[model samples]
Target: MSSPSREAILASASRLFGDRGYRSVTVRDIASDAGVSAALVMKLFGSKEKLFAAAQPDERLLGELNVPREEIGAALAFRVLMRREREMQEPWAMLPFTVQDSPDPEATRAEAREKYLGHIAALIGDTTPNRRHAAVVVSLMIGFGEAVRTLGLFDDWDFDEVVAHYGALVQAQIDACPVA
Candidate 1:
């Protein structure tokens, strides 16, 4: 049989982590599922912690932020709102605890959080002025998304409606800020 490539191993790991929760899954589980040796998994990713980080979908959040500088707030809010909806519909939405339980959990979360804040800071042209406010806005969006998912509101509400509503609120907050 042909050996699985590193990409294939990572792909299996991503799905497994997304489906089973990171802590619940093991190297053997990923290895067996990927049709690769556990040693290969370790060799490629260093350790399970590293593997989980590598497999996280945080990049999807970053990817969605590739918008015009002038529209960063609206763009970021829209992207996060959209991601929240997508995550809710996917099995992985129920598995954030997996990422939260990582060895460097704070660092992992900070990295993801920074991605959002950095975009806003760049758009506003000042990391110091209203940075806390920007952080709060992003936090609200994330918290609301989690709440919606936890409450299973997506079953009745369309994802786009959620994004648009939240996006408009975020835009209003941005507009309310004193001209920088």
Candidate 2:
């Protein structure tokens, strides 16, 4: 069984990491935010790297994209919107931070590419490796998330209408993926 302090520490870690990326935030910061001690955080998570790894789960949300190709774009759109509503943020929003703000830019970029974007590209493609098209779809998702959640651009827009319109835009890119 987990104690409330442990859960609070974890929640603080996730929020700090999500906001400041990997390198900038530290155990002390997370501890302060969680109202715990640095020693406790170190004892619990071992290290900042371990804390980061634990903070970001395998992004099961991406699994929803594994639908039929024809419905993939819509699925991506709907899933991202759902995630924004539920999680207040998406992995794509952290891409730039995970790379540019990290100590090891190349490794971070490659890992994120493989873990998040690569999975997205593979799901969006049949057999041809549709990386370019997937990039645009991810870009759309990131932009939509930023606009709707951060800037409140589409507050009054009907949910279904936003889904259909953005889903169509994402679908156009999915349809452009060429088969090998």
lDDT per residue (tens digit) for residues 57-111 in model 2 = 3477667545678887677767667766677446656556657766668887788
User: What's the CA error at residue 27 for candidate 2, in Å?
Assistant: 2.2
Can you tell me which runs of candidate 2 are displaced by over 4 Å? 1-3, 126-130
Question: What TM-score against the true fold does each predicted structure earn?
Answer: 0.65, 0.82
Q: lDDT at 100 for candidate 2?
A: 76
Model 1 stretches with alpha carbons more than 4 Å out: 1-4, 18-21, 58-60, 63-74, 77-99, 109-113, 125-130, 144-152
Task: Give the alpha carbon lDDT tens digit for every residue of 1-180 in model 1.
Answer: 234568778778877876667778999999999888999999888999889877766545444356554455556545645555464232224335544766777775676556767765555444445486566665665565555555555557666676666666666656655455
Clashes of 1: 0
Candidate 2, 65: how far from true, in Å? 3.2
> What is the TM-score (0 to 1) of candidate 1?
0.65
Clashing pairs in 1: none
Q: Rate the local accuracy (lDDT) of all candidates.
A: 0.63, 0.73
RMSD of 2: 2.6
